[model samples]
Target: MALLPVDDALQLILADARPIADIEHVPLHEAWGRIVAEPLIAMRDQPPFAASAMDGYAVVAADTAEPGATLRVVGESAAGHGFTGAIGRGETVRIFTGAPVPQGADAILIQENARPLETTMIGVVEPVQAGRFVRRAGLDFHRGETVIAKGAMLDAGRLTLAAAMNLPALPMHRRPRVAILATGDELVPPGADPRDDQIIASNSFGVAAIVKEAGGEPIDLGIAADTLAALNRSIDAAQAAGADILVTLGGASVGDHDLVRKVLESRGLELAFWKIAMRPGKPLMSGRIGPMHVLGLPGNPVSSLVCSHVFLTPLIAKLVGRTHHVQAVDAILDVDLAENDLRQDYLRAAMHRRPDGTLVATPATRQDSSMMRVFAEADGLVVRPPFAPEAKAGDAVRAILLRHI
Candidate 1:
């Protein structure tokens, strides 16, 4: 099969993937980090009524004159209780923050700007205008207004807004369940003493972590031997567990023992794309088996992780109906780079903010995709296009940030 470019492959994968239709209604507290399935509309106007914004004296604007003018305080209004008396000319009402302004009063003069006098009267230190410090009804939000839109991911701020809008629960897309299967005859589970030819099966753990970070629930299917029967059984178990996405590590290349693609085809999965023009992940494959989307990742540790970031994250986001997508930023290179190979490269790099506020990226000394230590210490990936030439200091480059460095 011909190798497809990174962009083309991604576009193809996304073209067929659709947002999951299954939704679950959860309480507002459990809705955090979940995607809203429907628009959340305000049931009632915020504030509901005109109220005071500070502890002050509510008075008719016409009654508030220049300094030395005194008005009789008719009544006091606190937060829950409101003054029922109508303010006539030369009359004022003592109102605290959030208290409903008295009838006929359009403005409030802060207590600091008023001098309390005997016999329920106070003198205005400064002339006050009408409608000042008054929070009108629906100032924050009006009834029937969309407080949150569908596909919006819930965060702390959004959750608070939903609660304030009287939303006790929300319908959100169900989180996708992902199954990770690691395959290799020479692979052993972590902490197991293995023969000299066997290496710890670490790809499943890393892939599971990536899936979790991407908001999907990962179900580790444990290590599958290189035998065809064992691999098929693992795939069957994952399907029985109701996994929405299945990820198989290793057995994707053209080597004699490589059997992932063959097994998937035999099990009736339609192949989408098998090869991509990406270093450390050229053998990546994606397809659909029954109702589950299956991804075949390269056996290398770094390759599995890179492939997960490139493909799995977006898949999870799409399935969960999230609107926001991951993006890469352009940065200036701080060191030289040699000529690139035919495949696009994702070199592990460290990112830092320079003194002048420009982003600076430096590639790690070791560019081997099999090394996990380098990937652990790296903050992002420096993207190099296929067939590109060497890069010098201060060269503009694109970087996909993993997290804030």
Candidate 2:
């Protein structure tokens, strides 16, 4: 049978994905990067009282009609303290920034615009207008008003807003949990002394990083020996951990040692599809086991990372209610091209900003699947359609940027 298209596979992977319904009460200072579960209302008006915005005289505007107008200084007002008496005609209060504007004062006369005549008197050197340099009550926000909408991501700015609203704790959606398992008897974790034929396992680290970056909590299950019993034990642990998504690396393709698909199926996993029509990651498996979504990735280093960028990140975004996605853009090819076949191609490539401000992508000479170094140094993946025609250098192409260069 032909392989499933990339778009179709993504739709299947995300079909059942839904934002978690559980709500958590997170402290205001620790609510960053969480999704708001309910609308955040202001508890009190920002700047509860009319405040002085400058370190100068809080005056009745009519007292400072023109330059050099004399006014008697009544009392002093500093931050967190207010003048008890009201300001009358031809009288002003010595006020500091953030101090409550005294009653009957309509404006502030900055010190630069006023000359001190004595400890209790000053001459206005500039005209003072009503409501100038005075922060009115409720100017920023009002009591019982909605400050943040539901489903909004609690970024740094939003967290500051929540604090200003007097919110001690915020209602947030629970974070999605992802469990990752790596298979193959030849694989070992880093820093371990490996035997002659064994190699360090790396796919799980990359996969877990992708999950965390996409706003999910990743629980590493370590490497499971290539046996059905070991695999079953790992599966049991993942389910017991209450993981919402389970990701398994290697053993996805049909091989003598590949037993992941068979074991999962025997445990009642509903296999959605086995493969996709994409190069660098064709033998991709997607299915569901009970309430947990499963993604079986290819063993090749480049293939696993590419698939994670294409599928795993999107699934995590859907589960957390995030709206942004990695986007593909048109670019110029800086090297010669060749014709393609049935599978869509994602070639690791370096990108350059040309003198004319155009972005150019040049594919690596060797497009091997196991080369982890290539993917590391690559700025993007140069995309080629199936059955694409041969092309020359400087031709227009499309690429998905891994990160900003």
Candidate 3:
């Protein structure tokens, strides 16, 4: 069978994905980083009335027209407390920031511009124009207005705004639950005394991190030995946990011990595609068992991570209604590169910025997929298209950054 193109495989995995319909009401404090399921409408106008913007006297603009005019202090207005009586001509109200402006007052005579007189009055030192220092009602937001629209992520700022909108709780979509299973008898959990032949299972942890960063909840199924019964038990556990996606690490390729695909197929998985035309992650598999999406990732550490970035990230993003895009930036190659082959290449490279702000990428001398140390030390992956010609140093190339430089 022909290997599927990377783009085609990704499209198939995400084509049928729809935003989760399971909605839950979450308290304001816990709503952060959750997707809003319904519009958050303002309960009342911000401030709900004309308010003083500064700690000054609230007065009719006309009353402060004269440079040295004296006005009687009618009442005081502080935050959450308003002067009930109206402000007549030649009258002013002692007010502080966020205080509601007394009725019939159109401006504020700032304290710096006002001189204190007897206990009952203040002398105007400077005049303030009408509407000056007065925050109009509904200036920030009006009652019944949509403060936050549906499908918006409740970030810090958005959550604050929702709280200001008088919403104690927000309707949010349920976080997508992803079940992660590691396969292979040669694997052991981290912090275990593994035999010389067995290696610690590390791919699930990285994949789980990616799942979380994509706004999904990761449910670890631990390491499953390379056997049909073990794989079946894990699959059942994932279903019991109501996982939306099942990610199987290792046992995906066409090796004698590769049984992830076979086991999933027996469970009635509708195979989407297996094997992608890309280096470092060629033996990738994607399918769906009923409502649960199934992804069989390669066993190699680098391959699993690269595939996660390329395929699984987008799938989870789609499920949660988050926009996902691969950020690729142009860079100048600092070293020569060989011509391409049938598969797309992702070369791990170090990155530097020139004094002129130009980015430079230097691919590692060794590009082995299992070299976790080399992959860890590199900054990003330099993308090489299939069958591209050899390029010399100083050539322009595109690299996908793993982190900020």
Error of 2 at 155 (Å): 1.3
Q: What stretches of model 3 exceed 4 Å from their correct place?
A: 81-84, 118-120
Residue pairs of candidate 3 with colliding backbone atoms:
none
Better of 1 and 2 by TM-score: 2
Q: Candidate 1 lDDT, tens digit per residue, 1-405?
A: 678999888777676778889888989988888888889999888888899999999988777765588999989999889898788989999999999988889999999988988979899888778899999989999999998999888889999999989889998888889999998898999889999999999888889988878778899999888788998999999999999999999998889898888888999998889999998799999999988999999999999999899988888887887643666988999899999988999999989998888889999989887899889888899999999999998999999898885
* Model 1 CA deviation exceeding 4 Å by range: 80-89, 322-324
Tens-digit per-residue lDDT, 235-308, candidate 3: 99999999999998889877888888889999999998888889989988888899999998889999998898
Clashes of each: 0, 0, 0
Write down the lDDT of every candidate, Cα atoms only. Answer: 0.89, 0.91, 0.90
lDDT winner, 1 or 2 = 2
Reference-based TM-score, model 2: 0.93
Ordered from best to worst TM-score, the candidate numbers read 3, 2, 1
lDDT of 2 by residue, 183-287 (tens): 999999999999999999998888888887777889999999989999999999999999998999999888899999988998889999988999999999998
